[model samples]
Target chain A: MSKTLAIGPFNDAERAALSDEFSPVFLAKPDELAGLTDDQRAAATAVAYKGHHAFGAAQMDLLPNVGIVANFGVGYDAIDVHAAAARSIKVTNTPDVLNDDVADLAVAMLLMQCREMEQASAWARSGNWKSKGEYRLNRKASGGTVGIVGLGRIGREIADRLAAFKMDIHYFARSEKTTPGWQYHGDPVSLARAVDFLVIALVGGKDTENFVSAEVIEALGPRGVVVNISRGSTVDEAALLDALENGKIAGAGLDVFLNEPAIDDRFYKLDNVVIQPHQGSGTVETRAAMAKLQRDNIAAHHAGKALLTPVN
Target chain B: MSKTLAIGPFNDAERAALSDEFSPVFLAKPDELAGLTDDQRAAATAVAYKGHHAFGAAQMDLLPNVGIVANFGVGYDAIDVHAAAARSIKVTNTPDVLNDDVADLAVAMLLMQCREMEQASAWARSGNWKSKGEYRLNRKASGGTVGIVGLGRIGREIADRLAAFKMDIHYFARSEKTTPGWQYHGDPVSLARAVDFLVIALVGGKDTENFVSAEVIEALGPRGVVVNISRGSTVDEAALLDALENGKIAGAGLDVFLNEPAIDDRFYKLDNVVIQPHQGSGTVETRAAMAKLQRDNIAAHHAGKALLTPVN
Candidate 1:
């Protein structure tokens, strides 16, 4: 009578480690677990969801005896915490480990847009190295205003890096914060007006829906650059496009989108912007740490200890 | 009789400042003024060349009585120092002033490519914000090896910035020299092999022609990136293109180019590279300082004092 566990889409190392500890039931899809024995299924203690899509309400029915749902990464929006709570099951996420990695990326994107590193590389690749030529200088990132939409862990990390560059840091939070060297703005519109570079680091919640709109973009003005490392739904996509096309805003650096892996053609044509495949916490080091944290959370739960990042 | 000074293209401030001291003689092309009277030209103590194209030996015949050729920027490749020296006319360049600005750009470019900042921005601009998704942490600049191709004033400034990022700094120089926290490599390939990121800060000289080639790019490997803040001729364009296309190197960030205002389509398509229109010293503060240096050089030379940056 070994304790049963379910896992899928976990990294090879994490999957193998979990199998060694419990009576593992590996399911390829949420809908394909109908063939499991009733007694084995009833013994399930933990389940892991590693995919990008939501583990819908229907999928939860397959793991009736599961007491814990351990999420692989910091972003647990795909998991229905409310539904999990109703069953008295503990919902856990891996956070804090990805802060430095994601913040490093935020600063990188800001410097790229300001300095135009890509266009310079193209010239070097073309064998056109001339001593005297017409070369336009990209904007400088130092000594400029940087506005953070959210002042959470990632936003605070970004501020620390920008402080190294001697940039004036500002933030728009739900309420006023008393952080030193950081000025507080009541809303996004005020933040946009106060800063040259606007960074979105707010969480993806109902209250934060469409936080950056056409009005906010316009308020940022022609020399402003917006960097979004948060949820894509926080911005009004149509308004951003209009702002970029009309030169109402200088440029942008975005890591997340409203819908992913299905990019639009408009992004391909613009030289003023930089694009990545939404990789905020996609580094090998960060991912491994995340997987290890999830493993630790499960091990602790079984020992009857407090979970590392438990959802209340 | 008025002191007639031959003036080439100068900034508005330089032109306005010189109006009080001498009668300015503006020339579209230096060679066009070859037929000027000896008495008229004898008063021409200074000549400026501001065009993109270099003034060769043929153009030197026009400035028979010129005492000094004050360049506006740090680079003096356009006005041959050897040609000016032969006629006993002093040549001066504005250096040191542009080092911080260029170094600022060099680091900005390096961060952009490594962080994939441009790609993130494009995701925001395309109405397909949902498709780009969240940032995946790529790599960190701190605790990495930074290889400098040249160890001049700008190279040193870049080294200082790398120190702030906690990166180990190495440099390739024409001759062996010792600098604290910097190890020198005799050749470009050795430097490329030892570094996670190679920064080109060498001057455009005969000794540095095609210094970075296929062999160098190959040595850098897939995890390494090359940053060119120097002239484009320092790198072998074909070799770099092949290396980038074949994934021999991770990515590149460049500021100078082989050709002016003309870039290849291949680099435009690559996701790893970051490009700019050759703007190393384009900041308003640095440009103004450079102009003042040029003016001071002219004033010092007229007073029979040693020029600040004289071409020996």
Candidate 2:
């Protein structure tokens, strides 16, 4: 008879935390709201949501009393905000807490790509270093021109770190930001044209679907590298694969790919690219912090206090 | 017979540059100097030196007329400066040019080790991401306490980059440097005790051999990671391997290892390590810059203009 409906796969610690604080009814997915007993649905005033599954108007209808949907991740792209807004439902997302981890992974992937560290590590492990005399020299990554496709929290964190590496930062956002010395491009194509490394940090969903178009990828010339830490929808994956295969661009460092996990098989053959499982915010410390923040927002909602990180 | 003798393997461009300017005779190694004719030895005034082979009194005695040893790398430990000084032969090393590349690699290895990017990438590329759900969580590297074993030019560059990642900087140097706010430890073991990540940046030579001793490695504890971008002589490789094997320490990112190229086979079995082929300054741009500096130093010595980057 609790007022919270916790959805998605919560780990043991998180499940315990939610039960201890809210006495919440836990379900594996957002669709489970329909199966909840009428009293359970009616009693659920706050939904502690996790996973990347769509939470739309149909699901929201089941939780008639759910005033807020507290999401586990920073990006609320999977949650249809318009549907929630129409239902007079508030949304809370765990932002800022995972920025460092996301930014760190972005830089890590870029470094891995530029250094060809994967091959180098393998060469060492296979005792090829003894047989091969010396490894062939690679292109330098530090002090190069890098373009950030979005100027949001995680993107800004990435730019700050790369700035210390002496990189010339160029960026593309809807409008110019106040960051001193960082050049602003009106369009992403222009941003791509201006740099050797192009990093996509755009928000997920429709507006940004194929935001890094084929044209933009084309602009990032043969010496260019694309590092994506954003959702797969932001980049033209087919075009990117073609470019990587045909040497249209130098390489890519991709963390997020379209239908990823089931990622393009072509990526497996390329030595130029560095593939990472969409692990931008996947760190022990950061994940724990994100979970805590999600719970704290749910706690705030239950206590009739302002949500810790409110969205719509 | 040319008065300028170039020892070790010089690449095509370096060879061309040496031939175009100095018309130097070439030898593959320092040991081959004994094969030179008396006239060739007596006429040779400058030695364009490369490789890590010891160029001691034995090597110098063969070239009695040699006035200077123009070394290709930043570290002159291979060229006994004390012996060179006694023989009235000046020693010049290529320094500062490769600092950025080396520092970049150190940070790259540290990031790769912390994020487990190698395994993560393998998971994604091997189609395990589709089958295995999410990659396992890893520790955060950014904002952690990192101890630099030496605060030289390359060490400072590494510290500056990591500082932007909000890392707490600590170091061990011969004497406390003028860097404000960066915690400095007077001894290696104390520095090892202070931080989670320990990066060795000490100069190579007898003075710094085993600088990162067994005691220092032991002090680093279980959660600690050892990153060595310096010479293998600086670290006790046996202890490091034992710690890595036994989980006495967390992991390692080793660029240089004892008898590298022919590095220990024990390292190949460790998944917790990032094994690089001693490619710190092994980038196209950095290698070119280093080669130019080496030739410039040679040119300066011949011009009787103070050797461009003199060691003795």
Candidate 3:
């Protein structure tokens, strides 16, 4: 039987599932991969990777016999595809299955920001609604114009949901794709300038770093709300923080931050923003699907089947 | 001027608009209606009413000379429309203008409850995301079955939005509406049993008081989530709370309660519930439109034309 070396920080169910088939060595973190013995590293034919830590050439070179890196998430920015391709190690990601969940979070965050739902919930839960009269009126979210920063599968899903809310949709992508009645922008700044809501759904990587630049944030102006469900590296975080602090834009709804978990402390104090812990694909059902997909890719690679959902 | 006597708690914008069109007396609450001089009461031909305090026959009798009561909101459950009808005094409510806003709120609340967005936002904002590994995964909101309690305009709007989320739509109304492919239940209990999420959008009045009974909550089962954006009287609050406490139902997202502002203290402690002050139509844009419609009704009534949205 071939060994499956699984990476750290999987949930109980995920661990059980991974253990049931091709029981593998588990490393606590990417840093711990170096501590493995020669026999242990050679025994493992496949690697099941998770988390946001960078897995570059240095890390890939450690597992000489490792045939594939099955990433548990759709965003494989943390994985160096160039390094994997150079070493002939196949890289596969779980996508499409998580699109609905991610899109759902994007819409939910945007509504939370526009409707001031978190504050309203707090007000009611704290017995202030009785003492403070009615919750103060908030900005209306429906029937407003929205700009989608990407036109990928997840972005299209988000645009579809917002469309049902009677929102005018505008989008920016690598090239214009024919979508009915939705306005297409040649660039992010123009899209930001045109819509009241700017939602980032761009993919992560080097070419896309700081895709939503300071100029884009400035163009979003006072009434604009920024909702980023894409990678943190895709946007200029310093610019976003500055814009939020000065009310350069109305507020923001953010899931991904430049630094995972240990994000900028400035975000903790702002009342205007709504933050989530990159839980876009964090639902029991979706996570199970993602886990299964990651495992299936590993299973297929061992069977000499073509890699499923391969990025490189 | 026909002397439009405007009643309590109007925002500055509403007050200004009312004053410009009909410069009449402005009383702070229903209790102050008795403080008016006989001449002042007689001079008032139309009353621009606001707030939730009951406008019974007694309050109506205080201003006997008033010909019409133009309510500021869609729900006239606070007003005794039957009494007005018996007295031959016209009653009108601002309706359709607020449907979009109320529908938007309903969807926002449902998504908030399903996604555990309030807790997730708190986790990220409080630096718990850094301290902890990640926000715990929650239930998915999309692709679930939903039951709309009333298939009125607002209910239809909410169902439409949820449909785009790939939700299976089921509803209960006075009679089956000619909707495409949506399952219509003859009663609330049946609707509750058939869906994962049940949303209350019924009109507030004697007819709908305690419509979402204990039986209905029980029928929804442990996997169920209730979302109420209708009147406080529409659902049995004690029953709903009991279900939430005992885990008879999964959770709830409520905007209205039996005693709002001073809602039940138990709600403040519950982790599964999401509460909001009764702000179904509370938006700067929608409120302005509602105020304008209310004024328009009064304006039309004084001009001896048909009331725009008459309840009596």
Candidate with top TM-score is 3
State the lDDT of candidate 2 residue by residue for B1-312, as single tens digits: 787999987888889988999999999998888888999999998999999888999888888888999999998888999999999999999889899889989998999899999999877776688987788889899989999999999999999999998999999999999985999899989998989999999899999999899999999999999999999999998999999999999999989988868988889899999999988998889888998988888888778788788887
Give me the runs in candidate 3 sitting further than 4 Å from their true place: none
Estimate, for each residue in A253-302, the C-alpha lDDT of model 2 and write its tens digit. Answer: 98888876787788889989988898888888998899899989888888
User: What C-alpha lDDT does candidate 3 achieve relative to the native structure?
Assistant: 0.90
True contacts kept of 2: 0.86
Candidate 3 lDDT tens digits, A173-286: 989998988999999999999999999999998989999999999999999999999999999999999999999999999998988888888988899998888999999999
TM-score of chain B of 1: 0.89
Q: What DockQ class does candidate 1 belong to? A: acceptable
Candidates' C-alpha lDDT: 0.74, 0.90, 0.90
The value of fnat for model 3 is 0.90
Worst 10 residues of 1 chain A by lDDT: A127-136
Could you tell me which 10 consecutive residues in candidate 2 chain B have the lowest summed lDDT? B124-133
TM-score of chain A of 2: 0.97
Ranked candidates (DockQ, high to low): 2, 3, 1
CAPRI-wise, candidate 2 is high
Q: By the TM-score metric, which is better: model 1 or model 2?
A: 2
Runs off by more than 4 Å, candidate 2? none
Lowest summed-lDDT stretch of 10 residues in model 3 chain A? A123-132
Fnat for every candidate: 0.44, 0.86, 0.90
